[model samples]
Target: MLSHHIQINDHPFHYLGWGDRNDPVILMLHGFPEYSGAWAEVAEDLSRDHHCVAPDQRGYGQSWAPEDVNAYRTGKLVGDMVALIEHLGSRPVMVFGHDWGAAVAYALAISRPDLVSHLIIANGVHPAPFQRALAAGGAQTAASQYIHWLRREGSEEQLAEDDFAKLSSLFGASMDMGWMTPERRAAYLEEWRRPGRMRGMVNWYRASPLRLGQPGEVITDLPEMPTHTLRVRMPHLLIWGERDTALLPEATEGLEDYCDNLTRVTIPNADHWILHQESHRVAAEVRTWLKRL
Candidate 1:
């Protein structure tokens, strides 16, 4: 894997790149606390046919972390993607994201459709369903309780002071017990220990409620953009883990209402961390979908 850094609005963004520059670009965004390395195995296969660019979104890995909570908002996060894509001189690239990264990808597609041609979302529900689920007060709320904890002041100190072992263990336990190798866990611990990085990661949840409270934003409406106004102009593939404990399956029940051209696949026996637990299957499906497109 090749590593590099780019500047977007004065903030340094760290990413991994593979394949030829002339090939079609597929930008991958990883979720909270995960760096671009999470896509290493998948990118290796995809790079054979496409340009794969996986960025460690702001506040994670080697990326810059701003102190302001607003920096972690979806709007700014999507703007960073726009800048990154433009920096690469690629427009309408295929974009794939998991977890919080998926939410950012959805916002990017909706807020700036011209920058994304296709979207592959794994283990995350649409923003509208997510909002409704949060309000309804059930499993979604229960699953998200950790977010509130993270948003509290001094939480990062507590987690970091513990050497990030607890946080690493939480991810491993919640996803796949054996998903994180010692080396990978050590890398995560090192990154989280960076100055202000842990706090920046937590700011994602802190700024989330602001986005959710936006007025005149219809979470249920099909994305409001020229390409998606009438129909989903870009092909969309949704891969979900049937055994996901973080995001309820019911959140995806009415997804078809938002996408005109949607293909849904469920991975049985997989949990929230589908990419880690079933990388080959996920990669194969992504490759097949890209070929069809």
Candidate 2:
């Protein structure tokens, strides 16, 4: 793998690249509290046949982290990827995003389907079903209490306190931590400790328009999703970890309403961090899925 920094939209963006430039492109996107290294293992496994690029993504790792919360909005986030793709060349690319990155990927595909060849969503949600589940007032609503806390001002300070004690705790909050070794932990800590990075990461939650519902209460007057022009027409694959407590299975229900060609896969034992917990298995499944496409 090689590391490089390029200016996109007049901002310095850092990314890890694997394989030759002539190969098929797969732009991997990491979620919250994770940098490009989150895709290290998976990128390595696929680099032999594909050109894999995973960027720090604005607020995490070595990328540019604008202090303004507005910089992390969905449209801007999607624009970054669009600019990255244009910078790479005018070729259609496959996109694989986890967690928050998945949300951005969905938006990118929806906003400009011509740029994305295939959409791969791992343990993430589409806006419609996700918004419904978030406001459903049950276990899902209860599971998402942390969202409110992370959205508060000075929340980054709280996460950065005591050497990121709260941030570290998040990895094991709803999933196993066996995949995160000491070396990996150190790398993640290094990324989190970067000046201004924590605030930028949390800004994603604050800028999001999605809201969580109260448990056992009726949720009304929620903003309606776009009935037209919000559909994902490209072939899409959703690999879900059934054991994920953070984003429960219900969050993905009715997702077909927004996707035209959607294929769903369930990993019974893996949790939210399935990319690491079952690297080879996930990689193999992705390979097979791509072959069928």
Candidate 3:
């Protein structure tokens, strides 16, 4: 793996690259509380056939992080990826995203279909169905009340206290976190402890316009999704760790209607952190899914 700190859109951007430059590229996007190293294992395996570019997104790791909530807007997040693609050949590369990274990837594909060749998401949600589930105020909204906490003022401070015990607990979140070994936790703390990184990371939740319905109450005031433009024309792969508690299967219930070609796979033992819990298995699934092309 090679570490690079390129200036993408004038801000210092960091990414980890694996494999030969001439190989097919896969842009790997990590979600909250994870840095580019989150994909190190999977990328190491896939590097034999494909080059993997895993960026630390905007608010995580060594990447530039502005504390203002507006700076973390969805448009700017998508634009950062667009700029990264432009700087790195801008070809229609395959995109693999997890958690919040999936949000940026989906928006990038929807806004500029010419830039993304294939879309891959692991235990993430598409906005339309995600919003629907949140608005329905069912299991997902109850599960997602954490968003409100993250959005609260000074919550980031609370999360950073006690050597990040709160953040660590949040990361575990009742899921099988056996993958977050001591070494990995130390690495993640190194990233999180960076000045302003915690607030920048939490700003993602604060800046999001998506609304959460009161648990047990169906919401009629939810915003409308642009069904006309959200069509994902590329081949799409949805890899699910069936045990994800934060985002239940209902979050992806109607995802098929938005994609031209969609393939879904489930891993029985893995949860939201499937990329970490089953890295090799996930990599194998990715290779098999790509063979469709």
lDDT of each: 0.79, 0.90, 0.91
Better candidate by lDDT, 2 or 3 = 3
Candidates in order, TM-scores: namely: 0.90, 0.98, 0.98
Off by over 4 Å in 3: none
Model 2 over residues 1-293: C-alpha lDDT tens digits? Answer: 99989999999999999988899899999999899999988888988899999999989999999999999999999999999999889468999999999999899989888899999989998988888888888778989889989999999999999999998897689688899899999999999989999999999998999888667654777887864667989899999888998999889888888888999999998999998987777778789999998
lDDT of 3: 0.91
lDDT by residue (tens digit), candidate 1, 1-293: 78998788887889999999899999998887687888887788888888999998988888988889988878789888999999999888999989889888888877777888998998976776666665555666566667767778887777776677667655655666577788877777777878888888888888885222222333343333243442344688999988887788876666777776799888997888888888889889998877787
**Which candidate, 1 or 2, has the higher TM-score?**
2
Clashing pairs in 3: none
lDDT of 2 at 218: 45
Compare the candidates by TM-score and give the number of the best one. Answer: 3
TM-score of 3: 0.98
lDDT of 3 by residue, 1-293 (tens): 99999997889999999999889889999998888999999999999999899999998999999989999999999999999888788498989999999998899889988999999999988999999998887999899989988999999899999999999999989799988788988999999999999999999999998988668878887766766778889999999999999889999989988889989999999999999899999999999988867
Q: How far off is residue 178 in model 1, in Å?
A: 1.1
